[model samples]
Target chain A: MQEVLRAHLEQIIPLTDEEFTFIESHFILKKYKKHQFLIQEGMPVKYVYFVVSGLLKLIHTDDTGKQQIISFAMEDWWESDYQAFYTQTEATFSLDCIEDSVVLGLSLESYQTLCEHLPKMEHFFLQKANRGYMALQRRLLSLMTSQAKERYQQLIHQYPTLVQRVPKTLLASYLGVSRETLSRLSFGV
Target chain B: MQEVLRAHLEQIIPLTDEEFTFIESHFILKKYKKHQFLIQEGMPVKYVYFVVSGLLKLIHTDDTGKQQIISFAMEDWWESDYQAFYTQTEATFSLDCIEDSVVLGLSLESYQTLCEHLPKMEHFFLQKANRGYMALQRRLLSLMTSQAKERYQQLIHQYPTLVQRVPKTLLASYLGVSRETLSRLSFGV
Candidate 1:
């Protein structure tokens, strides 16, 4: 699991053995059962989790109690109620495991201190943030322009494993389509 | 214009006169008339722009040739065909002026060199990217959950001046509403 974390970090920036040791000190590994909440709406977001195994969903529920999936995280991906995490405010979103999961959680203080200790880590996180921003931009554009069928197809093309791993109902929510429509699309009806 | 850029940077990280001078040197100042293209589809994205004054729209045209407004960038905002800018690839989106505009453009090479020269700038950019990502999360969630009218109202509440400044047609396009529907919503019918 620690090797997973080190490998993910090394994908962006090469890490010395000592540097990896220092970075590893900042994170705590946690295991969660399926459907376990890593973050709850209205609680302070304590850590940004990097998934070492299994899958997680970050969701926002509206006033009518309808849940909209904002994003899904799997191996090597990061998840959090990011605005709350960054601002030290109450979370407006919740993160829950879709499967029994293992993740490395890094608190905001450790993130900042580690960045200060290693400017290279700051660069690594910067790249990660930029990539997240880019992915969101693409998603926003897709939502604005593409139909649900196209979105699902694009998703399948991009992450066939994700399509296979996630349940059809959750995939429907993520694509903002009804389960019936998703089933039709999935079955090529 | 340089002072405006300096002030924006200072909002995140304090800087000395010498530091500002070094930072300012990496950017090129340019002015565009309304409807002028800052970036064109299929062209390489040369820089990411920070608006000093006026407004721009980042647009994506679908296969059917209908344009989608990805976002509006007004004073003090940053806008670009970001994926293309970061990856040094041909742009799929076009950035054009909505009003006569002044912007400071930073090329990728300059950005990397600047961050390397001043590690604080790396932190500054990281903060900016995180904020962008957080904002996008809110937007994606809204797109999934909110009606066009609610989205329009949210936009008005967030940026009253922006609502007033932008044309209604573009606003309709941005909100993904028909112009007539937007007019009715605007009139509170």
Candidate 2:
């Protein structure tokens, strides 16, 4: 589990053994059964989790209980109510495991302590944040400009693992299209 | 001018006198007349500019020369070809002064030197980048989910000064709507 986390970190930033040890100590490993909620909407989110294995979905539900998938977390991906985590607000989205999963979780307090003690870690984290921004920017642009078919094509191209693992209906929600629309786009249209 | 710049810095992170002096020395004051390009597309972007006064537009043009406005900068705002500035790639967008302006420009080399020398300054910049990501995320959501009218309303509510300073057509482009659509949205249904 530590090796998986360390590999992801090393891909972005070369960290010293001491820095790696600091990160390892803060993370708590846990398991979740399929369809379990890691976070729920309107609750105060205290922890951010990284998927060590299995799958999770970050989603928002409307007044009528229709869900909109915001993001998917596969192995080695980070999942959190970022706004709630940063601002101490109630979460607007819930994070749920779609499959039985192992996760490494860290509380907000411990993350802050990590930043305070290891400034270089903050730099490393910021680099990852920049890459996240780049990915989000591309997703946004595609959402704004692409047709349903185009979006489906791009999604398959970009997240082949996600397409293979998650249901088509959930993928349609993430793409902001109707399941029927996605069906046509995928099969017929 | 220095006082105004110092005030901007204080808004994000309080800079010590020595740190302020260190940054001030690295910034060069640049002036641009209305209608002149500050950073042109296809060129290597060497500097990121902070608006001291007046307005600037970041624009990307289509194959037939139809312009899409990416963002606008006003007083105290920072503007750059972020993809180019960060990666040292050829700029994909052109930045033009919408009005006569004075800007504090930092070359990539100077900015790197400052970040290397001042760790706090590096954190300060990283925080700004995080905020940029947050803002852009909100913008993307707004663009994807909201109608043009809602987008225009949100824009004016957040940056009324921009409505007064920027032209209607550019604002339309920025909102991802036709000029006619913007006019109707602004005037009626």
Tens-place lDDT per residue, model 2, B1-189, is: 888899988876788898899899999999999999989989999899989998999877656676767789999988988778878999887999899999999998998788678776667777777777767766766765677998999998888889878989889888999989998998973
TM-scores for every candidate against the unseen true structure: 0.98, 0.88
Please give the DockQ score of every candidate, comma-separated.
0.94, 0.42
- Model 2 has an lDDT value of 0.83
Q: After aligning candidate 2 to the native by TM-score, how far in Å is the CA of B94 from where it should be?
A: 2.7
TM-score of chain B of each: 0.98, 0.95
Which regions of candidate 1 fall more than 4 Å away from where they truly are? none
Docking quality of model 1: it rates as high
Candidate 1 chain B lowest-lDDT run of ten: B135-144
Question: Which has the greatest lDDT?
Answer: 1
Question: Predicted candidate 1: interface RMSD?
Answer: 0.6
The DockQ score of candidate 1 comes to 0.94
